[model samples]
Structure formats: C-alpha cells, structure tokens
Target: MAQGSGGNVIAAICNLFFPGLGQLVQGRIIAALIFAIIVVGGYALWWLVIPAIIAGVFHLWSIIDAARFKASD
Candidate 1:
C-alpha cells in the first residue's frame, strides 16, 4: 500500500484502537511487536505519570507511523 491510501487509513484507525494493531495489519510484525511492547508495558505502569505520558506519545506515534507507511516498490 502507498502512503495516504485507504489501507493506511484503515491501519491508522486500527492503531487508534490498539497501538500495534495497525502495524500488524500492514504485515510489519517487528514494528507491531515493538509498538505493542512499549505501549502495553507503559500502560501497565500507568500509575507512574511519566510512563503513562510516554505511552500516550508512543500511541500517537504508532497511529501516525501506520498512516504514513509506504510499501516498498
């Protein structure tokens, strides 16, 4: 899929619900795992304000990353 395509839009929506899900949908297993681990781990430690903020940042990053992803030609 190209960047800014329908697939990217769907992936972005997926990431909106779950950070790593969009990467997974785009067939990027490593990115999906990394995003999932960081986001989920941070959320698990949400009692700490810093981690929670970090999680939120990562979550938005994940969404944007998925939205902007371009498949290699």
Candidate 2:
C-alpha cells in the first residue's frame, strides 16, 4: 500500500491462487518449479492424501517466504 512496498507483498498475494505462484512472481524460477512439482503433484496424487496435506503446509510456507523475501536473500 506504500510506495516502497516490495514485490514480496505482491508475490505473497499471488500465492493465494496457487502454491509456487508467489515464487514465480518473485522470479524464483527454480523454487517455483520445485514447489509446483511438490504441490501440484501432491494434488494429482490425491489418493495418497498425506503428501497432499504436506503440500498444503508447503503452500503456507510459500506464502510466508514470499512475504519475507528480499533481493539480497
């Protein structure tokens, strides 16, 4: 909402639609793909269930990470 607000805020918001989307928004290509595999793959294998739940956790982590991401880190 401020002039200096970083891309992380935007990225985190983007993550709401899907996991790894934030990373993609932040230009974290590898992270995006990796997360996409983890989360998307988890959803694909819905029968397994456990991994999918874990992926949900990962998605939450992604949101937090994106919110805190900095160019330096």
Clash number for candidate 1: 0
Error of 2 at 13 (Å): 1.0
lDDT of 1 by residue, 1-73 (tens): 9999999999999999989999999999999999999999999999998998999999999999999999997
| lDDT of candidates 1 onward, in order | 0.95, 0.80
| lDDT per residue as tens, model 2, 1-73 | 2223567788888887888898898788999888878888887877898988988888888888778876753
Please give the distance, in angstroms, between residue 48's alpha carbon in candidate 2 and its true position after superposition.
1.6
Q: Each prediction's TM-score against the native?
A: 0.97, 0.82
Which residue runs does candidate 2 get wrong by more than 4 Å?
1-6
Residue pairs that clash (backbone atoms under 3 angstroms), model 2: none
Clash count for each candidate, listed in order shown: 0, 0
Candidate 1, residue 53: lDDT: 90
All predictions: root-mean-square deviation over Cα?
A: 0.6, 3.2
What residue pairs are clashing in model 1? none
